[model samples]
Target chain A: MRFAEAWRVALDALRANRMRSALTMLGVIIGVASVVVLVAIGTGAKREVERQVEGLGSNLLVVVPGRIDIGSAPAVSRLDLADVDAVSRVVGDPSRVAVTVASGETVRAGRRSDFTTVQGVLETTPAVFTRRLGRGSYLTASDVDTSRRVAVLGAAVAGALFGDRDPIGQQVSIAGVRFRVIGVFAPLGQSLGVDRDDEVHIPVTAAHRLYGTQRIDGIAVKAPDRERIDDLGARIVAELTRRHPDTEFSAVTQQQILGVLGDILGVLTGVLAAIAGISLLVGGVGVSNIMLVSVRERTREIGLRKAVGARPRDIGLQFLLEAVLLTSIGGVTGMALGVGAALTADALSPVPAAITWWSLALAFGVSAAVGIVFGVVPAQRAGRLDPVVALRAE
Target chain B: MATPAIEAVDVSRTYQLDGVSVPALRGVTLTVAAGDYVAVIGPSGSGKSTLMHLLGGLDRPTGGRLVLGGREVGSLTPPELATLRNETIGFVFQAFHLLPRTSAVDNVALPLVYRGIGARQRRERAAAVLGRVGLGHRLHHRPNQLSGGEQQRVAIARALVTDPTVLLADEPTGNLDTVNGQAVLALLEELNTESGVALVMVTHDNEVAARARRRITMRDGVVVADSAADDPPADSAAVPDGPAAGGDADPTAGDGTERAEAAR
Candidate 1:
């Protein structure tokens, strides 16, 4: 028999048992939907991490203080301005490096007070972190050299302290020291749960005086090109170890961070897909059960068809097509539901969620495979029925 | 000479029931030429239905040879047997066997579907045959919507749509009332005489068997009496009481004998 005829017959049978067909499809729908939603979340997080790392500069590397074993206890090692300068010299180009030191503090503007992070940074901070001024000018090299008490308010901090009013020239007290706001940085949104828009930036010397600490938190190094980032990171790590022989520090390139993030997210996506696949297996078993029952119920009809010259393969194809059609419809419905859920999540929450084309294809492919895998037993059983015995069936 | 439409040479069949053999047919030899309307009648468990099944290629004999449409039924593969049945034999069951929730036209078109015919042609042919069975106006009505006579007619249309060499009907009117049964028998008579299609019917009713020009009475899985002159026996009283016993009651009986003679 032709596939078209078998498909039509299958459709007719399914239509005759509408409630049973729908119930059979429920498992597949849930499986596909969960897979789609979970994969979307995983991909969304990976994309968000990539965006944040790119924002920090594509050819960037971060060098931070690492713990050192002093005697029987683990001591927190410090990285000072001298070590930053020494690493800059090792980098061989003054134009390729920026350094920053941060401390959490309470900032008060008249009656408005908010707990926010304050960072001490050089003039090159704007280029290294891709921060552009929304109003007024960024700090100049001369400002940092003179240790001027000026600050740059992050977009969120500016909004909180001054509301709609411009805060570029306003005074804000940080750790009980008042400083003029030099510029309000452009909005940078949140990434990996950190709000980049809710921070204050000041000169390194001013931050050191305010926080009573001369130690730097971390140093940022920029490669001339993406290809040189690993080499630059290696050179900075070697130079830091040479300068502070007893202390420890580690340098990580943006690529390393992205690779680690991808591995973690990829595993997460795989695990979620596996869990969803179990539901698909359950759905397939359900299809097999229903088809077996259908074959038993329609034994007389099968015998009649056989009497009319239908071959065994024809009957088998009809039932198999019915299974495929059921699962495919469920897959389509599940895809729509999954995409709807992802879009809803994106709209309501800070975590990004998106449906990719590959995920859609995978879901459909798996559903079809499920149909065939589960459809085989019942189809074979129907095909192997004895026509005379089947005719005798009530 | 052309081969007979159906010929059974000492055919026998036995069923294995729980390691015990139950014989259904034992050495039943018969010949049905093309265009011959033959009825096999007997009481239950006489193996007449087994003969019908073997003739239709629905079952193979455990022993002996049964030929249908000039092909040895025992030698053909399962698929080849299916094809033979599809193209050479049509079956009309006692139950009508029309698919429920399906229109009469679709039920008629079912045989053609297995032939790989396209939908448009299948529908056109199904409609034509249904019209022949006097169901043209009721083509779209489902089986449940039709009366017993109408449903039987639809089943006849399905059997005839394939234009097979012979129609094998097992108690075709067993589930119908007298008026409907007589109507169906009359229709079968017309098809055999006018269309020249062979007919093999199994019936318990002597009145129904009387309509056929040829009659075979089975007892204990063997043909006890055959109306055809070639199979005459001394004990002719074994022939049941029917118009078919006289042989001259049917106007077309002479023509059937002449055709059988010409083939030989």
Candidate 2:
């Protein structure tokens, strides 16, 4: 038979049992839609994390005491202010170096008090990191040299301590010491699950006195150029290791961190897509089952057509076409539904969703293939039916 | 003689049911020529339907050669046999076996689909044949929408649409009322005479068998008699009878007293 004619017959059969056709398509619809939606969610999350990582700064390198690699325990870290000076000489840009020590402390300003994270930082903090002041002047190098009791408040800390009140000239007590708030950082929300806006910054020398610790937590350095980042990290780690032979230091670049994170998210996306594919497999089986039932129901019709003139191949093609049609239509509908759902979820909630064309194409191709894989036995059954027995079937 | 529309030489068929051998046609020999009208009458389970299937190339004989339109059925592959059936034979069943939801014209056009005819021409030919069967006005009516007689006429039109040399109709009038049966029977006779297509019908009704130019009677997996055997097979390719021969048809048309006439 002509190809168009075969399609016409298949179409007629579906139209003849519209309710059955739609019900059979439901399984594939859900399967493809879930795959698209879930993959979108995974892609959206990976992108969000990338944006956050990139937001830290350009050509940024972090040097920490000890090995952060798997299967290695970190040695007791002894990185102090003198080590920071050694790192500054290695980079040849002292203004690009910054150190930090973090502790949770309670701050009292008049009648209002807030428990917040207090960080020790240098005057080069804003230069090495992408931070801005919303009010007042930031800490100066003289303030760190004098061990002055001055502080920079984060946007949230300032709000909590002095609700909409200008905090530049105000006094707040931190770790039981009175300090003047020198500045308030801009409204940066959250990064890597930590509230960036709810912290206070003090001079490194003053923090050491308050916390009774001579060790700094970590160091961040900005490389002069992107191409020298890896070399710069290695040089810094070598210098730190040179100063304290007993302690090992590791310097990590942003790219390496992103690679690790991207690998993790890629696996997550694949896993979610695979889980949704199980539903497609189930949907394929449903198509096969429905095709079998259709063959059984149309046995007499098959007999009649064969008696007139249809070859076994023609009959087989008809049934196979029916199955393919069912899945392809369902696949398209599912894609629309999944895209709509993903966009809706992205818009209404914090969960990010991005619809990638590859995911859509993969879902469509697999759904069609599912029809073929699941449709074969039933179509063969229809073609192989004995006209004699089939004609006699009630 | 025009390659004999069908020739079965001692064709025998045995079916296996759960390892039990049951013979349906025990070496029955027959020949049906082009432009012939023959009726086969027998009770149920008598191998009459089996004979029709073998004659139409729907089944293979176990014992002898069966040639359809000058091609040996045994030598043809299943697909080749299907094509042969499509080219040379058409069928009408007692159930009126029309695709239930399709319009009459489309149902009639079905046979031509396997012939690779385009849609427009298929429909045109189908409509022309349906008009000849007195159903020109019911071209768009589905089976459920049409009366029983109209449905049977549509089936007849489908059979004739292929322009086959032989039309194998198994109990063509069995599913209709008395009036519809008479109408269907008359239409079959008319199409047979008007188109000169060979007609081979299997019927339980004796009166329906009597209108044919020849009659074949089967019993117990064998053909016991054929009414026109006295005449040469080629001579039996006469035209079908007129409408006047319906009620007062020859009682001897199903004449089977000449027993064991076809182990030839």
Candidate 3:
């Protein structure tokens, strides 16, 4: 039979049972919609995590100054200038590497003083953290070596201390010692839950001298490239283990953090997709049920068509096509709804929502395949009907 | 000798109902020749419909050989049988089985569409055939919109659309009044005259049976009479409006030998 004729007949048959066909389509619609929405939400959460991770820079590695044991108290090894120089000379790929000596301290801007977590580092610390200077200068190696009390304020810190005015060359106090603000760091959104622009940075020696602390808390490192990250981390760990065999500190790499987050997101996406998949399975059942009812209702019509020279193949095609049409329509509508929902969520949320073309294609393709798989029984039943008995049926 | 248009040699149909075998037709042998108008007359439950079903290839005979148009009916597959029906035979039913939702023209165009005619040509052919049945004006009317006589006429038009060599009507006028029945009978006669298509009608009406040149009477799945109508008297004779009643004095009357000869 010609496709036009076949399509017309199938359409007519569906239209003949309008309520039943619409109800069947409703199953497909809900199934596709939920799958799309759930997938979008999952993808959105993943994108948010990626942005957070990116804010900290892909090559950045955090070195906490302690071996954290499950049942024992963590040992704090005060990170100091000697440790920073020793590690810098000990590590290979010196050109791509930068280090930081991190600690927390109290500071005051005039009468307004706040206890803020401060990172005391050399000039290269901004590059390691992927932070940029928005105003004055970053700490210099000269300042760190001379133990000068010059500070670079984070964007939030600058805003708190100076308001609308520039805080460069202004005096601020850390541990009751006056320091001059050199530069303001640019905004760096958020890393995990911590606002990146809220901390204050000063030279490592100056921070140690002013706070009367002779040690640094930890060091941060950045590798040149992704391929050398593990190599560099291993070298750092081997060197750290050698230098501080008694102190005990660990070097953490980006891959470990990325892998942990990936696993968590993978499970989250899996759980969400599985729940949505259940609805699709329910939709398939709906298609089967509706088609079964259609086959029963149109038994006489099938017989008549067969008697009138319609082949079994024609009958089968008609029913199968009906299901495909129904589900495909649902798939398309659901994609639109899903994309819409994702966009709406992204607009209203601080976290970003991601919609990919492949995701949309997957949603449609799966629905169509499901329709065909589920429609088979009904189509076969109609095709195999005996004309003698069918024609006799009321 | 030539083959009959339809031939049944010891044909039978049996059904198993609740493990009980009920024979609808039992070893019935009959022949219908080209250009012949034959009526199989019997009451309900007499197996007339069963014989019709067997002859039309709508079903298979449980026993014996059946041939239609010199082709062994049992040799054809279901699809082939459907094709045979589409091309070689047309059916009219007692209830005037027109698709309820379709226009009369569309119902008539069905066979042509099955034959794969283009839509435009199908409509034209259906219109022309409906015109032949005196229903040209009612072509667009649905079954519900048309009167009983009009519906039967549309059914006839549908049957004739395929231009089949044989028309099998199972009580074509069963649902119509006397005037409508006469009108349908007249249309069938006109087709038989104009096209020389063989016509087999099943009816319980003696008045209807009188119109056919030959009549086959059935009882208990057996043929009681395969005879002809009486000749009209020379003066003031009424040439029965349809088939003449009773079986005698008709030129098409059976001669045990001509039954064999008419097969030619």
Candidate 4:
């Protein structure tokens, strides 16, 4: 039989039961939409993490002091300035090593004093961490060499201290000790949903001597290149292991952290997406059930067509085409709704959702497959019907 | 010496219901030459419809050597039989089974579609045939929009569109009024005379049977009479008395030899 005639018959059948066809398609729509939205959310969160990690530069490594023994239990490690120098000697890269000591204290600019996080860092911290200056100039090597009491304010700190005025070459007091603001750092938007432009930067020696603290809290090291990050991280771990055998130090490369985060998100997205995919199975079953009912209802129409000279294959193809068309239309609509949801969620939240064309193609392809898989039984029934009996049926 | 247009040898059909075989047609044999108009008349249980279904190749005979258009029908596959039915035989039913939602033209074009004809040519051919059957004015009207007689005419138009050698109709006028029935019969007569396509109609009306050049009367799964009338039954029948004379006002009611007497 002609394909056009078969399609005409199928379209007529669809028009005959428009409401039933639409409701059957709704199942597929919900299934497709669920998968799209779920995958988008997971991928969006992952992309946000990647952006943050990349912002920290690909060659960076973070060293956080692990558990240490106290009176009765393990206490946090008491990492010090000596450990930073020892780490630097073993690594043999002066530009890469930087020690940071931080404290929460009130800083006064003129008459206003605000409670903000104050960090004591080496002169090379900006270079090591890839931090850029938005105004004036950054700390020079002479500043850290002479243990100068100079400070640099972050974008948020400068705004809070001077409002619309420039804070370069201005004096700000930390813990009642005045320090010159040499520069203001550029604004870094939220990283993991926390504003990073709100802290104060100062030389490490000034922070320890002024606050009467003897310990350094953290050290950030930069490798020469992305390929050396893991090797450098291993070398630093070996040095730290030899220097402080009893102290537990955890050295994590940025790539390792990124991988771990990606793995966790992958598992989460996979599970959510798998559960969402079950709806498609239910939708497929829904299609088969509706097709079965349709075949029963149109038994005579099929018989008449066959009697008038329709081939069994023609009847089969007609029913199969109807099912495929229904699911495909539903899939397209569901994909549209899914993309809209992803875009709206991205617009309103911090997650960066990117809808790709491949995802939409996948949705439609699955929908068409679902149609064929489910349409088989009903199409076979319609094709195999005896014209004599079918024509006699009520 | 030419082969008959339709042939059946010792054809028998049986139905199995609740594990019991109920015989419908037993050891029946018939033949019709091309261009002949014949009728098979019997009571409801005499298996005329079963014979018609078998003759049209809609169903296979349970036991028979059947041949149509010089091919052994019993050996043909389902698809081959369907092709033969489409090319060589056309059927008209009592119910006028046109697809409910389609136009009359579309219903007539359905047979051509099954023949793998293109859309444009099929539509044109369908319109042409509808015009031949005097349904050109109702080309786009659906079955519900047409009168009973008009719908049957459309059904007849559909049957003739393929130009089959034999037209197998089962009670073509069973659902129409007397006047509409006569009109349909007259149309069939005219078609047979003009086109010279063999016409085989199943009916219980003696008056309708009288119009055919040949008649076969069946009783209890067997052909009791097969005759060619020099003077048709209507011209000779005026006395209405008993079952032996085949004179029941209800033509379907007849005795054992009534079919033979009526044929003579």
Among these predicted structures, which one has the highest TM-score? 2
Which pairs clash inside model 1? none
lDDT of 4 by residue, A304-365 (tens): 77777777887888898888877888898889888998899889976567776766787778
True contacts kept of each: 0.66, 0.80, 0.25, 0.47
Can you rank all candidates by TM-score, best first?
2, 1, 4, 3
| Chain A: TM-score in each model | 0.87, 0.95, 0.80, 0.82
lDDT of 1 by residue, A1-394 (tens): 3678889889988999999999999988988898898889888988888888777776888887773222444235478888878887888876567887888999999999889999999888887767788988887788788889899999999999999998878899998899999899989888657999999999998888887888888888877888877777778888888888887777788787788778888898889888988888898889989999999999999888888888889889988988888899988998999899988998999768878999999998999888888888888888778788888899
Q: Given candidate 4, what's the lDDT at residue A336?
A: 89
The model with the greatest lDDT is 2
Q: Model 1 Cα displacement at B124 (Å)?
A: 4.2
Off by over 4 Å in 3: A15-20, A58-86, A90-123, A133-185, A198-219, A225-267, B18-20, B217-264
lDDT of 4 by residue, B86-131 (tens): 8888889888888898999999988998899888888899999888
* lDDT of candidate 3 over A1-394, digit per residue (tens): 3355567777877778788778887777777777777777787787677767876776776666666333577566666667666677755434345555555677789877766777767777766777788987788778977988898888888888778987888999877888999999888866777887888888877766666677766677777677877776666667777767766676676667766777788789779877887888888889888888878887876776666666677778888888777778778887888788778878997646677787788889988988899888899888888777777777
- From the highest lDDT down, the ranking of the candidates is 2, 1, 4, 3
How does residue A147 of candidate 2 score in lDDT?
92
Of candidate 3 chain B, the 10-residue stretch with the lowest lDDT total is B248-257
lDDT of 3 by residue, B153-255 (tens): 8988888888887899888988987656666776676677557677999999887887787788888887767774233232123233433322232212123
Alpha-carbon shift of residue A274 in model 3 (angstroms): 4.2
**Position A162, candidate 1: lDDT:** 93
In order of the candidates, what TM-score does chain B achieve? 0.87, 0.89, 0.84, 0.85
